[model samples]
Target: VLVGRDIGTVVIPEAPIKFYIDAAPEERARRRYHELKKQGKHVPYEQVLADILRRDRIDSERDLSPLRAAEDAVRIDNTGQSAAETLAQALAILRAKFG
Candidate 1:
């Protein structure tokens, strides 16, 4: 699982698998821009892109809890997939692994 700061330190029950999901900076920026616009918020694409880039840099370079996948974790790049497609893929993997 891809965990943010809050859940990273906790130990959960044993599971057979875990994965980290990520997308390219440009793709993430575009998605964020569209989501904000859909919510009737005014934000430019350039601003969203800049914010994503900045956050990406900070996440990668953070001294503690730097954003990275565990050695055994599968990494999924969801840049091109629609949300439903991504969820379907993830569910398929879970079923295959845990059934």
Candidate 2:
């Protein structure tokens, strides 16, 4: 149940089940925008998008423990999916792998 950019890749590479959940940068920015707005933050969507892209680049290119999925990790791209849909997808993976 660990969730982080490098958890599966660096922190615990030997974990039996690892998931690399991802979404389009625009979708990620949209989610962040709504989350910030709900928290009463007045950040613009474009700014959020730029920030996300910049952070992604920095994280992926950093020399120390750069972000990456484990070779055996399950990849999930929930670009246009709701939370429940994503959960269902993960659950299905778990079921398929463990049951």
Candidate 3:
């Protein structure tokens, strides 16, 4: 399953393949802000950004199962890439791997 940092490390270590999609904290926060706004939650952008940053720190420093990429997982950074580009890259990788 595509999931959080611990999925490959703890939950499904035996899966033959894995991928991890990443983005900058600011980008992540922006996405979250829009998501909540779409849901009609009237929250400020600054608050969402602060919470996103705080969660990043906590997840990074947690003792058990700290957030980290798997040793062999494909890492995809979507910082500046568009959604279409990201999907194409991901699909290309999968096709190459399984074809």
Candidate 4:
């Protein structure tokens, strides 16, 4: 199974490969809002954005197992990329490395 965030640095540290995906705060919040809306979750955008920022800070600044991109991880910034586009990029990388 694919893990996220602190996967490489903490959980499954011995995994053969790892990736770090991130987006701008505003963009992430917007995406999250839309996703939740589609699910009928009526949470406010401001609240979601605030929570996202808060979680980011806490995860990044935590003393133990802080959320960090491992030195060997392939980083992907999906700020403007669609889900299909992002998946294609990842698949391309995987095929190039494994095939």
On TM-score, the leading prediction is 2
Colliding pairs, model 4: none
Candidate 3 lDDT, 1-99, residue by residue in tens: 466778988899878888888999889888889999999997899999999889888998999998888898899999878889998998999999998
Tens digits of per-residue lDDT, candidate 1, 47-96, equal: 99999889878977888777666656656789988988888888898898
State which candidate has the highest lDDT: 2
Residue 70 C-alpha lDDT in model 1: 60
* Pairs that collide, model 2: none
> Model 4, range 1-99, lDDT digits (tens) per residue?
576777887887777778888899999999999999999999999999999999999999999888899888889999999989999999998899888
Pairwise TM-score winner, candidates 3 and 4: 4
lDDT of 2 by residue, 23-67 (tens): 999999999999999999999999999999999999999999998
Ten contiguous residues with the weakest lDDT in model 2? 1-10
TM-score of 1: 0.81
Estimate TM-scores for all models.
Answer: 0.81, 0.97, 0.88, 0.89
Per-candidate clash tally? 0, 0, 0, 0
lDDT of each: 0.75, 0.95, 0.88, 0.90
Candidate 4 displacement at residue 81 in angstroms: 1.2
- Model with the higher lDDT, candidate 3 or 4: 4
Off by over 4 Å in 1: 1-15
